[model samples]
Target: MAINKLPIKKLVEFRRLSKGRQQTFANRLKVTKEANSGGGDYWVRSISTISNAFRVNDNALIKAKLEEVSNLYNAEQRSQTKKMYKRNIDILTKYQNFDFSEWWPSTSLNFLPKPQSILEMHGLPIQIRPQQIFSYGAENNQSVGGIWLITWLQGYKDEDLGIYSEALFRYLSSYYSEDYIINPAACMVVDISKMKVIGYDKVIDGEIPSLLDASIAKIKAHLN
Candidate 1:
């Protein structure tokens, strides 16, 4: 049997959905064996720019990338692609002035490749993929790191943010614990739309694991 795969953001959204919606999502997942690649390059361009900016400590790259997209938006003739480019332009413009130093003062960011691991839930192999990982300096001279999952969707409640943070924390702690100490300060879900960061320290729900397990069980049942 082929194992099911879900990005961390989709899994978090699934957890917050109503029972009816969960089943609907599960049915869609079951039938859609291939990855959905229909979305435009807005997220792809933006994420790459953000990653490159951190890797080289150059915020200018952000504006540079925005200009590239803006130029394309201006000349595009297709309405749909033009709309996508326009949206990307707006998002990149907002992010161009963002100060990474404010959130990660005095720390260096070294970007690692995206991480993925298979999680067995209710006798099912569910692959979880988080977007980015970076190692940063800590106060005690300890080597610690964090995983960041970006979300373009808006209106995520605090509870949703907490669940997303906890899920990313568990993914790193379970898979990469031997390599580096996963710091709560490092793990985060970056809300690009609102220019907000939700860190692992904000995960207040002690029952997150149980909640996730229940959500997984429901997903498994619906898969059948």
Candidate 2:
């Protein structure tokens, strides 16, 4: 699970607790990722405030310790994250001219063969309708949760097909956890790191997404 604000602290605090108190801590973490990870402050606060009403066995103290840890770590993470996000926003915005905007989709004049499209350094995703989303999980169809990278077919008809992901990719670093990314083609399933591009095979005739994925993989390999 993606380590969120309070879990690490809560876990650490639990270690300080006596065995009985530790059991309570264990129960909370076991409840759900959302328990400590979800960002709604009201929800987070309720866990402790409500527990005070029922601190039957060192519940209140353990909880208070956990909250302290959570708040401290979250604050630190927020500060560090803010700096990184600002850096990201600065870089992404500085390169806005290179975005997948149709204004200039060809390769740089300095380069030969006039490149078709440029890859945005930031990773971005398309906002296809629920109906338009093409889901392909593992062989068992068990590819649950987590961000999935994807590629798309571009042609004369789709100039910006794999360029910039969306209009809001730049500003997102300010308020969200995602690290912005842009691949030359929309043909990858990557995590937050933005370093790996998943490969794909095509369906002979012409499945747009499939073809796009395969082409993206080929080009990406050469670039690396």
**Which parts of model 2 have CA positions greater than 4 angstroms off?**
1-29, 33-81, 90-187, 190-196, 200-224
TM-scores of all predicted structures: 0.80, 0.20
lDDT of 1: 0.63
Local accuracy of candidate 1 as per-residue lDDT tens digits, 56-100? 667799899988988888899999889877766766677677776
TM-score attained by model 2:
0.20
Candidate 1 ranges beyond 4 A from true positions? 1-3, 13-18, 34-42, 110-117, 121-127, 138-141, 147-149, 153-155, 204-211
- How many pairs of residues collide in model 1? 0
lDDT of 2 at 195: 22
